[model samples]
Target: MPPDYPYGDKVSEPISAYAKRIGIKHETVRTQCDKGILPIIQRKKGTKREVNLYALYLRAKYKAEQFIRDFES
Candidate 1:
């Protein structure tokens, strides 16, 4: 985990919280989720949505690596 990761030890977090933690607008996160760009799961009985932090972290890592490889080439 990054030194500044908020919600310590949390595997999944609400979309709004995750957006705030990452310094982005919650609406943007919602939009991404609606578009299927970000992985998310809707709560079984509510309108609340949560994002899988581990999946997000892995996705970010993969994107970073891809960028690095492209830059190196």
Candidate 2:
């Protein structure tokens, strides 16, 4: 598990907290989730999105390959 995972190695995190942890704009995370480019799970019904930190780590560690595959598929 990543030591720097948002909220101390949480399996999942809210878009805002993830953005803060990674030092990016919260809206960007939200947009990515909304576009289904980021792996995410909805919390309950009508709640904000929660992203899988491990998936996010994999995506960032590898970068654009994920985007390319998603775009192609």
All candidates' lDDT scores?
A: 0.84, 0.79
Tell me model 2's lDDT, rounded to 2 decimals: 0.79
Which residue pairs in candidate 1 have backbone atoms (N, alpha carbon, C) closer than 3 angstroms, thus clashing?
none
lDDT, model 1, position 5? 58
lDDT of 1 by residue, 1-73 (tens): 7765544788788888889988999999999988989898776856788988777777887898999999999
lDDT against true structure, model 1: 0.84
Which candidate ranks first by lDDT, i.e. highest? 1
TM-score (all chains, Cα) for each model: 0.64, 0.59
- Model 2, residue 20: displacement in angstroms? 0.6
Candidate 2 C-alpha lDDT tens digits along 1-73: 6665544657788788888978999999888888888899786889777888778767776776778888999
- TM-score computed on alpha carbons, candidate 2: 0.59
